[model samples]
Target: MHPLAKYAIGFVVLCFLLFLLAPFAIVPSGMRGVVTTFGKVDPVPLGEGIHLIMPLANRVVRIDVRVQKAETEGDAASRDLQQVVTKIALNYHLDPAHVSTVYQRIGEDVENRLIDPAVSEVFKSVTARYTAEELITKREEVREQISRALVARLTPYGILVDQFSITNFRFSAAFNQAIEAKVTAEQNKLKAERDLQRIQVEAEQKIASAKAEAESLRLQKQEVTAELLKLRAVENQRLAIEKWDGRLPTVSGGATPLISINPQQ
Candidate 1:
């Protein structure tokens, strides 16, 4: 063989050797790698960065240990046997130190297999302890209960529950209508009470006005003298004479007819 051909073959061998020795695996940030040799899984997980392992015998499976969010919807029965549909948002993360164990036991699909079911179960358990009305009105308390229960249940499984929120709660149509009707009735009752108060205030004002008028009349009567009374009687007689028709007076008794004179004269 020629000298150049030999050099080309040597270069090809060097390249093949380099390719075979490339066993470095890079575990990205926020993730851990589970190293398995043949069929046996390593107890210690590889942290983020480049790691060297047996090229052909060892396989690295990366599992994300960062916080993740999931939204789930389900229905549960309340304490009063009312059906309630709930939507929840959950924030959780896998334990970084137990990535290998989690992979071996729970697999990478933890959200679907473990967390989602846990959420449903916790929701059902907590919801059953309260009535539907209480669930709707006391939503914060219900969410806290569910969160505590989920944390207690999932913590041992190498999963951490960071937060939980009840996004929506839906009830049956009949119940919603009843709630609306109840609200309307309460508003009407308040309006009726205000109207009654207004009427009572008006009635009180009228009574006060009548009492004031009676007092004014009594004061004027107290200010009257006998001479003033006589003057008022003369004025009344003058007004009656002016309004009388031209007719002779008819007397059936032996009573004397007296004439009145003006006090100004």
Candidate 2:
């Protein structure tokens, strides 16, 4: 080979090696790298884009320094001594400023080593303060307490606890059946009570109406005296005589007529 051609080939090979080594020098966006020179960690963190480091003596540990989520599922004990399976999901992120401390103390397995324990502890502690009934009814309060505790415990470990949710809880099958039965019985009782109230209300209305009618009759009796009674009887007799549909009765001796007519008519 020609000397110039050999030199050119060597240059190309060097460029190819540099290209392969460039990944150690550069990091993707929204990422931070820790420089570990011969397994010795540097306190200063590496920023995004190209960086200069020892090709063979140094390496970079890339970490996603952004918000992330860690969800966990487990069983917890309720205040009522009930074993309930629960799902706890947490929104968390690594603190870019404390990446070194995080890596050093909790390491890359922070979710399992640190966050998991903290989540379990918080859930157990908070749930212990509430009964099974309250766990269902006042769930928001319990969740808030757990969230606060988790935040306080995880913040020191460079894990910012953003939000947490208690997704599901399963109670004993017997307890669930009992609850349903109790609710059904309550509904039936309410319906019966409402019906009884309606009947009583109707009875009261009828009694009032009867009393009103009795009072009216008493007033009519008072208005009708002996003279009014005689006049009413005479008027009824006149109508009956006028409505007679039979032959006239013959007078024997001097019998007075039942109805007298005016001579002018």
lDDT of each: 0.91, 0.84
lDDT of 1 by residue, 1-265 (tens): 9999999999999889868776779999999999999968898999989999888888999999999998889789999988999889999999999988888998889989898899899999999999988998898899889989999999989999888888799999998998899999999999999999999999999999999999999999998999999999999999999998956578888675766768998
TM for every model, in the order presented, reads 0.79, 0.83
Worst 10 residues of 1 by lDDT: 253-262
Question: Tens digits of per-residue lDDT for model 2 on 47-74?
Answer: 8888888888888888888777888775
Off by over 4 Å in 1: 1-11, 17-21, 226-265
lDDT of 2: 0.84
Best by TM-score: 2
Q: Model 2, which residues run further than 4 Å from truth?
A: 1-3, 20-24, 237-247, 250-265
RMSD (Å) per prediction: 6.3, 3.4
